[model samples]
Target: MPWTVMPTFESYAQAREAFSWDLPDEFNPAVDFLRKHEDTSRTALRYETPDGGLETYSFDDLDDRSDRLAAALADFGVDAGDRVGVVVPQKPQNPITHLANWKLGAVSVPLTVLFGRDALQYRLADSEATAVVVDPDVRETVEEIRGECPALEHVIELGTTDAVSGEAHAFEDLLESYEPGIDVYDATPETPTAIMYTSGSTGPPKGVRHSHALWLGRAAAAYNYFDRGLEPGETTVWTPADWAWGAALGGTLFAAWHHGCTVVGWPRDGFDPEDAYDLMARHDVTKAFMPPTALRMLTAVDDPEAQYDLSLETFASAGEPLTSEVVDWVEETFADVAINEFYGQTELNLVVGNSSWYETRPGSMGKPLPGYEVRVLDPETREPLGRGEIGELAVTSDDRRVFFDEYWKLPEKTANKRTEDGWFLTGDLVERDDDGYLWFHSRTDDVILTSGYRVGPMEVEEAILHHSDAEQAGVVGVPDETRGEAIKAYVQPATDDYDPDTLREEIRDLVRDRLAEYEYPQHVAFVDELPTTTTGKIQRRSLRERE
Candidate 1:
């Protein structure tokens, strides 16, 4: 369907002017956000370590440490627009480094600590990153492959360690050596604040850049959506600040700071639901954003009824499509608290979501937020589709003020996908309902075409998962001359059903009963596990690799 809402301020003409919310000339995200809340004496960050120790940082404390770190990074020749690869787990140090880079007007390239040397080297070379902030445990991997990564100039370890190479510097020592204060970079809305690398299953990773305005818009929307009333004093704890998942960490950091609120973080490796619950209860976290997987794990915990009050005003889930079943469970467990789900990607920030003011639909990702336009379009012709028609999802840039400029140094690649018809084709397909809520289907690459019908694997899998015996499922298409391609399902059973043939037939029968006959899997394989990427996205390409 066509976008029902018209742009109030976002237009082609508005693009010439800045899209940012105006602040003082000296304003930088790091200082303006932190210093604005420094005196509140509220816990800015509630942290936990891999070894299960908890720590806290107030806004004032975080500001000081970040400033010192920014100054230290400057000493290592980090400058404006310089790319820095940071591979820290979910800790306060992640945002500290991120904000410090923002203060320096440098592009922060945050990498997941779980990645090995090859992944690290690829990102470093692709981004031409200047320095790396890595965990002490993972430093050896980078060190072993440093010779392969020529663009990487410096290494800063997060914890104190004696395994320093000639090129490595201690993170604590770097912070201690810097003087008290340094000048923060004054970035315009045009300045690129951060470059997030997409986990390209189809190809090499591509860097998606965001301006200060884009990041802040998402944050402000989140705050306003929750009615959190973050008035320069309150704090919010969000866990797992992996750079790939920037919407939760990056968006929360900016949004909390926009209202002068504190941003709390959880421990790196110890991401237990119990620890997260305790940290929130102890620190009194008022706002939070977690992945759907974490939420699922949270529901599985014991004595959730008697656990901490969980007095949070707003709780959200992003990155992956959250199922209605998960949402219902959260609402039931948490006194019907609004478990808001937002939809967006690395290429575009939070584009659509359920807000506090609006009544949320159970399965809907909500409507398009202010300052953006979204539509469902035919994948081939790029023609706008009517409501209830299933097609490719796209967003327009006529309201260009907030849109990304281009993929850095990858012009052909950017143009090949992001189009000039004002539509940036999001590879995912969707079907807009009569009420204007968008229902997410599989990615265009994941949609299985069989017998002249487009079958979304999510639909089939959701039906299959409804069966109690099914624990996990992955669906792909295998070549079939008669039908073009037929649906093939890979399942991991919840029970010890050693007889694959019986379980497979039962699953096929279950699918046939629940879903359309054409949508039922013609073949079922009971495997120990389905191949997945580092971030847990099932690699359908790998399935296609099989016969």
Candidate 2:
């Protein structure tokens, strides 16, 4: 296999100075699998079925199936530049559909199976997706929205649930009917490849579209973030996060496949700590793209190492900032693993993060990744800010490969994400230190102004989580006459046994002492559960709506 963006530098400084994105004029994500069409024996995916059975797919297998599926899609009238939605979990069909879409020069729109009718309809209609590949379980959901989505012509069933062939085309039969080994499309770096939707935490979900170069842009950062392709062993990768999320798809699965490594997938309803531990041990997973929330949930397992034998080497985390407590626990839990915490968004990802080349300062987003010039900019002036100055984090286009193409036809929304001089605004508040480390404060909108002080919800939530009883915390700014906006915390206690009134006081005191007195939440409401995305990130906007 021809490896892309191999790391040769010994230190982060050398890498920062030496690295540059070198991509070919013609690029497609499928071609990143350099060893494809040759090796059928080498495993590409290892998926665990619902009945506790394991299914494996090799590179040759994927190539053939994807070729057939691509031919079938062509017969369905899916052409170049068309959008094909893949709305399934971590199944083999998920990867197959994506590969087929790219091979035909069509754009793949990945939608999580966790979305409801309105959520699914909005994306399908917004993208005007012509065809979609869905598991039988969610075929009914898609069928229900067919009337609203006039552009959708074909619904292809991917899995078994006895869905009649009358409603949707049987994916397996279509694949069998088509012939394999069709010619792969030669696409330019600017060829539209994917349109990924944001989590819609703040507003309606917007489609962050990208070119084929997105893979090349993300490949280098993924290499560094995952410890230079997790060398020195038979690297088996896994992540509990949904495959639709950027972190898991781009960072974990595609990165692994590009490097000819094995990726394991287990489709489950929710994150079960016990089941997660068992799966990791059984598969001997050496690398993971674990979200911070998943790491927090795994902490509840008492002596996990004793109960399960794990061979994890690199545990990469993102989606949310890592708190000191979780970082400390990760260090103590995994003796040999490198905990690399990175930073990125749906629009621009893997731009800044930590790798194995340097010492990671706790709670700080590491220096800029290769080919990206991330900076702190004055929100209003659009001017670069000095080190340690809090401002909006922006990606100055040192290379467009590390950025999205557009907001998928939403010209006005796309315009708002960029400054006139051309810096892509992330709308996140952060600070870069003199040492070249970036620290996240909060979203520009999530920053709470209370009693003449600027308070970030993350710092407050981190302190609240420090309390032994705090299982989860979502902080927001609520309306207040006295203070411009009061800091209100929605807390999920660790257990049902704790006294709510007493624990609330303790939480308030913990933040008051750990941080400034002004940072503590004036209003603490204990709830059984907090609203979260499928990836386990707390939806602060949902909490805001509760006000």
Candidate 3:
């Protein structure tokens, strides 16, 4: 199935001019992807299990399961607009959970398994999630936080429904209880489908509300990013990035499905370079959305090309900036692979990215993507800045395809993101050169971007402060070799009665246990006091400068 609205242009300028969205008055991504691409023999999802076993699933298989799950959910009191948390890995269940929620016109919240109790609690509570579908690994964590989240009721585990008691139910049992197929909710482009959460400089994590139109919004970028594939049927897309993040869910997963391309899923406990190469080779993966961090790690693999018969044609990466060293290495290793790096956040994704159809500037996020008008604006003034001026990158706020609906329930924060006229102010600061390449400078806020994961210093600080011996904690991002930036923490002891060495280890362990494993501070320093503002707030900027 060739893309209907997406343009096939000879040049970048031609693509920009010809590109346009064909979002209809009514749209539902689940129905569009699953129902539109229905085929009995074609594989919709092929997951590589941990034991080196391959699980192939067709669209019919997934559609039937989602339909049954939808009926069960509706019977369980889940109505349209209710929030359902999906906490599974990159299994078929992940997509099934999402489709079932969308069929009900309810919102699906993609919560990553990387998050620990504290990180998980913030998203669940703030979204007022009515139910959570979790795997065995995270079922205990969700149960622990259930008391605090008053709105959360159902706890669906991925085991036998008969094994569960009280509010807890079996995922398989629910589907079996109802027959395959239900009335999918009729929706428009503006119907809210998913609320993905992201950490910020201040307060708890905020849920980014994206409507059904998000899938179509990301279509053009993915089509071009994956080298236009030349043929959709032969295209096999794969990514090690977790499905919960925008990079995987929108960029890799739905993007391929929209064009009727096949997708490969290989979930890993920890990213292994050798294992990644082997998986891709075995599956004959053609297109991938490999993050820069994963690419850098792959460099550690000894003679990958000679050892594995990898068939990658397009390798598109995001999350963090692609370094010149990694870019150079990829070109040398994979001769046929066109390494394209894109830039965007959860609020508005794929607005700016590199493509295989044109010349890519080495250190720049290629020209603003088609259908998105990106401008450099003064951080505080909201005025458009000149070509050479360094300012925050802002996108026109009206494009339903390129912008978020609002920060879920955060009216004031949502209002603060747009100016009087309407431009969603991305906190990222960049400068446009004479050639129109966007060069990143820094962020207006202090949220640390480490290992492509946005680690809010505030979240890490709370984890550090959780320690009994900790007093004040300040966190910042510092330069690192592998990870684009490493998280460093400056801790103040609550009392001199504790030993610095013991306190340092305790702080690290506390953070690791309370948050995502990656968000823990890589570098720790015991301090008498931290640099502070006149208002007595810990100044992360001052700590970053100290590094």
Candidate 4:
């Protein structure tokens, strides 16, 4: 069965009228993908591990494994509407867990392997996950926090079981014991499929709940932004982002599967420019979407085009605003390839972007996609802002084509995101041009964007304050060449006798131990006091301006 609804628009006016979403009453992503693409022998995923091991999973292999896993999970008492936390590296098992969860109507909460015990505990506690799937590397962290999560009943270890303890079950053993051919659950389009967590300014990360139809909504992006009307099974998509992020989950994994394209998943301890270049050449990637930081690093390599045989025809970037220099470098390096920039939050993926059908404006996030109603609104009045005036970017809440269901377990925060009338306010600040292009502005909140990761300033500040030598700390994002924004910290010492060099290392170590590695401040400046308001609240904007 061919896809009944594929967005193919010649112009913006045609896109507005032609784009319509129609999901069946009972929809499962695994069922939908397998049904649409009848060729079960075609490769669905081509994964490369850090140790130079290559693995390929065809559609049939995926279906069988996921069915077995679903059956095994059901035997373990996992039910519909239950949350299953997945903490694993980028591999075939990660996507298997996701499909298995959808097959059983369970919500999969993908947690980054980079997260520490405290960070992991918060999400597990908040989501009340019934079971968690972990790789052997993260098994110890899960075991340490297993006691704190009362709702957690099972810990399924992936890869090796020797390190597992405390009522843990081996993932391989469960799959071997369970029978295949488990029935896929009938889920409504509105049923929650995944609860992806994203960092905010003031509190812990908020879980962005996405419906089962979220995969269908991503087709608008895959067709327009990534592959540009490429035929099914013709394009190969690749990204450096982990499965935990929307870039990899929605953009690379779901989008490719939805379109019947091969997805390349590479797992690495850390990003290396040489490894990235080698993977693209080795995999014959036809289309790729990467963060601005990764793109910049790849462009910085000497004779990048000469170094490898890049098969990329369409390249898209997100996570942060792309600089004009990088844009120029991309054009020069990958001659004749269309390089587009996209803008969207974790809640709603790819709302506004430069599509293949549209003209690329250097430094401007292109017009809103077909199904979304995007606009710039005044932060205070909730009124639409005119072109050239900076305001909060918003999307009409009535349009469910590309919108999040809600923030999981945070009704108050979810309510705060929307206006009384209808618009869902995105905390990002942007301005629009008369031509409908959106221009990037600073974030209204204090969350820092460094190398494609959203780093909460409060989290880093709290970690800095944990150091005995630190009295008070204010964090801000400053312009960076490689990393879209580099985190900078202004620290006030508790005593004048403390050494700045020593305190900096201590502060970095504290954050590295407590939070994700990408969140630690890259630059630390010792100061007597930080700029503050009359109420004693630190003025982060002022600190940003000073930088």
Candidate 5:
């Protein structure tokens, strides 16, 4: 067997019918990967630094390093079910730490490096993490908040740098001192593997605990949605999303490695279109996934096709709704490449997406993936809505492929997301057509009501982005005396020379011509940049608060 898509079927319907999820009594993702593939020489991870440095690791190497790190963690009194926070970048050490945790049956808590001191402290304190593995660059910040976190006991530092005082252990020293032989823990499918925090755009971040079976659930997204059935050592997958986010960790790293494909990891120093384009060409990347913000930046690049010899065959976008303009730009730029858009959350990995096997309708989020079912329901009535009616998106709770165990410790919050009839409310508003394609409307809170008319900001934002001069747009409702709320848009200009007054009027006219009278933005303000999360999702709540 050459690591191709297993259980191959003739058609998508056949594949969906044949798809079976059977997990062993004791399963670990890392162990399962090594067991399935006998050839240890295959490349598992391929990493590149910001300044052109490259490194490749084999499965054998990862197994050995993860074993050593697991032994060291055991020596440090880290037992099964203990929370170990990881705050490293998208390097070899990040995945290594995660694998080590899985081997020990401990929960791995991923902390983004971009977090400030307060956000970092909140997570550490909230999770009650007993140990943390961090890079040398973030050591000082960790130390500053160390005293505030009462549960954190040990600080394990990676990279070669000056060690801090107070019980800090060197990562390399542990690997050298400990024997690299330990039995893999008998972790069942329900065992906690990782706790990923939400971006907290609305409020404080909530930790979402996922079971060990999450890696197995990701197969549909990888094999079906991504259409990556590459042979061993043939496919190169790349994503700029940090390892902390579920998109990069589960979508790119684990999904690619599960299929024995090489995954590319790079540092997240702001988005640079030229550098990103060059990396894909240099590495011959065949599949890539990016956030909508990054895609917008790449579209803004002058002569993108002439800049680099892009080897990308398939590209996908997530994190937010992909604007119609960006979708058209991708088709025009990558003439032959297939562009698919996916939808998922921190709790659910890939619930809905357009696959290469299906026809992609721009601005539509596609249908439910195999093993998952989605529906649109009225918020107040909790009744399923008909086709073409906008309502809150909900997933059937019985679908094991796309459900989380719980919201870490918040029982009330977890209970609130589920309906009495066993459907998980996604908090996102969307509509399904008669053809079964899902279309994004807005977040329940992001929807605007002006003069007794309901509006979705995405519709107005899409119309504004249709203009040649507008790079990015954020639409929200501001206060009004006559109308309950008025539409206001924050526009980021594509060029610096354009007059703000003229551009604003142009955007307003475009919306008026395209949409209804109440949907047009009454106030337009030009800004250099909009607020975003670490994962590049626009902060609409923050935008509304500024008004």
Candidate 6:
């Protein structure tokens, strides 16, 4: 049964009336759910690894481990407002560390293992992290740079064995040695909950601090979007764990946990459609959230999709605009289970989303989620643009619900992003239709100008996705002598049987027929897969660098 379709929510209006405004007095984003349901021994987390090893944790298990971890961190001299860095994969230890940091009223800095010494050093120094919790394998990177990170007080390893002797504390050992208690400090809505770093194309990452109120408001927005259908003790699985560690850790895990949902994580290393299907099926997941890349891979798999029975009620994708083909395949295969696409960055949480109750449009990103005020402003003048005009998408600063506090240690950058009238400049160019649906354009810098035509890559990519053989396509601008700039598409073929050269020619012909003459890609390259960040976004900068 679909969790959302069930009477878990009495009605759409009821769910909205209950969660649409602010949270009730009894509800707390942290501690309340765990403390109240400590005895609800239902499986809060059901995880399986690449090796097929399974681990299950009940609500009691999560609460106990988190409390013990909190005590251990407190013992290590961790205190309120201190920043602690966590570098781990999709495992039980990830949330345990988050809860531990939250217990001491400290900010959790989520880092991925893929980040080498320079990225890690920069983040540690930038956030001025007091300590670090990382997987044992990645401890070597931290150990080598310990001399430079003077603020790093200790290192906590989260693997089977420690890579650094005496210097690192085994995560499991700390939990095993301690006992559960309710000694966690009380954090107010204004308390700084996290410092999430954005993946910047030009410079080092920018740290964005989010308060407890922002997180709480985000949870309410997610709950409202899902029609409050996510019940207590239900399993939700999302991949690329530490990649969007801040979003997944802060928004998904913490948000769901607050609503009494079990967050399931796994090692989403390579793109294996079969493995993804197997994991979803085996886990009996109720809610699944992923990026556009994962959805494309899942849709490209061979048919007879009924073999893998997915219990997903809410299938949500973020990070990038989703393709219509991917959304259609999911709904068709899953008996029309709603596929919600949300738009937001590390700086802000879910400001716009396609909720269950609302009707979904093919290429639109739905409306601004409740409690958030969205505006499309002229990039140059910073004045609001009328509907149907393409402009920068921004959130109102006065709302305070979905806005970020500031970029930690980067005041100048923060000031530049926020306007004098208190609107956050998203830097993303978007178009809003009369019906309030928001359509995505290319990133501000990625907008292409060819032969006096302003072309957005998404529009061209949508045309390419219609081709049967084309699994995924990324359109970028390459220098052109005559037209100033021309579209270059890098495509990943869905099947192994086709000839690359023939398909490339066919795609060009298809785009020429489907799109404007100047908008068609003059250069096409067939590859195994488009280069992507850990979060499954095609690193357009990397593709442009290839030219």
The TM-score-based order of candidates, best leading, equals 3, 4, 2, 5, 6, 1
Candidate 3 per-residue C-alpha lDDT over 105-181 given as tens digits, one digit per residue, 9 for 90 to 100: 99999998888999888899988999999987888888899999999988898878566655688998888889976
> Model 1: which residue pairs collide?
none
Stretches of candidate 6 exceeding 4 Å from the true structure: 1-29, 159-166, 224-227, 234-237, 240-244, 397-402, 446-547
- lDDT of all predictions, in order shown? 0.69, 0.81, 0.84, 0.83, 0.78, 0.71
Task: Work out the TM-score per prediction.
Answer: 0.76, 0.81, 0.97, 0.96, 0.80, 0.77
Candidate 5 TM-score over all chains jointly: 0.80
Q: Give the TM-score of candidate 6.
A: 0.77
Q: Encode model 1's per-residue lDDT on 1-547: one tens digit a residue.
A: 1011111334323522433334233345676567754364666666666666878787777777888888988988999999887777667777788889988999888776656554566677888888888877678877887877788888888755465655688887777778657888888667777777664324455777777656655664565445544555545645443534566655676566656666665545435778767777766677777666567667767666477866576677665567787778877777646778877766776777775656778878777665567889888888889999999888764345355666778888778767666677778889998877888876777767564344567666766787777888888878764455688998878888557777777777766654445668998887778898999867777987887
Q: Distance (Å) between predicted and true CA of 526, model 4?
A: 2.1
Sorted by lDDT (best first), the order is 3, 4, 2, 5, 6, 1
Candidate 5 residue-wise lDDT, 1-547, digit = tens: 2222445667667655665555556678768665467577888878887577888889888889889999999888898999999999888889889989988988999877766565578789899998999877678878989999999998999843355445688887777777767889888768889888763224456789889878766754766666745446788888887787777788778888777788888886667878888888888888888776677777767776677887777887676677677778888877677778888877877788887767789999988876677889998998999999999999863345346888888898889878898888888899999989999987776766554344667767877898999988888888764444689999989889898888888888787655544568999998899888999767888999897
On the 0 to 100 scale, the lDDT of residue 357 in model 4 is 72
RMSD of each: 10.6, 10.0, 1.8, 1.9, 10.4, 10.9
The TM-score of predicted model 2 comes to: 0.81
* Alpha-carbon deviation at 103 in model 4, angstroms: 0.9
Q: Between prediction 1 and prediction 4, which has the larger lDDT?
A: 4
Q: Tens-digit lDDT track for model 4 on 278-340?
A: 888998888888888888888758876688898878788888898888778878777767888
RMSD of 2: 10.0
Global local distance difference test of model 1: 0.69
Model 6: worst 10 consecutive residues (lDDT sum): 1-10
Better of 3 and 5 by TM-score: 3
lDDT of 5: 0.78
Report how far off residue 346 is in candidate 5 (Å): 1.0
lDDT of residue 539 for candidate 4 = 90
